[model samples]
Target: MIIRELITHRWGNKELVTSPSFGTVEKVFVKDDMRVLEWEPLFIIRTENGSLEQIAVGVNGVINSVHVKEGDHVIPGMVMAFIKDDLLDSDIS
Candidate 1:
């Protein structure tokens, strides 16, 4: 996938919002280097008033790495993980 399109919404498209803002890591549902599907929850974040929000993987890819664990603080635009496209020929069929 185009990394530029993944980061910048230049085409009215969707990409993983890696960092919405500094928030506490509430839970992690995915593991490192694992295959994930689009719209799958990768992490749950405790952002406002102890409320939990899920961070989803916007595309199908392998979890290259995880940067934070539960209770860790995150930053804006920080690459929590890296994902490479798992495009199969049949995906378009």
Candidate 2:
């Protein structure tokens, strides 16, 4: 029998890549449809303290979309992009 979990628990496929800090986006390393590895540097942010912080893609996936551009001000938990996890697709497909 196939056991399925709740929608909130099954966050495998399309996932939102959110910002962990309040800052201005200094740079974006990948564009839409770019494949990325887990922990790969995806964005650089200039924090309110004026320090540069590198944000990494936490999942190995193809970037489905990018919401923020360089110079965009972002707050913590802001959705920066949507990524479709490669491993997640394997299970669904």
What lDDT does each candidate get? 0.62, 0.76
lDDT of 1: 0.62
lDDT tens per residue, model 2, 15-93: 7877777889988998999998877878888888888888775578898889999999999878888888877768563
lDDT by residue (tens digit), candidate 1, 28-76: 8777778888777777777646666777755786666677788888876
Predicted structure with the largest TM-score when compared to the true one: 2
lDDT at residue 17 of model 2 (Cα atoms) = 75
Best by lDDT: 2
Error (Å) of candidate 1 at residue 46 is: 0.4
State TM-scores per candidate: 0.69, 0.81
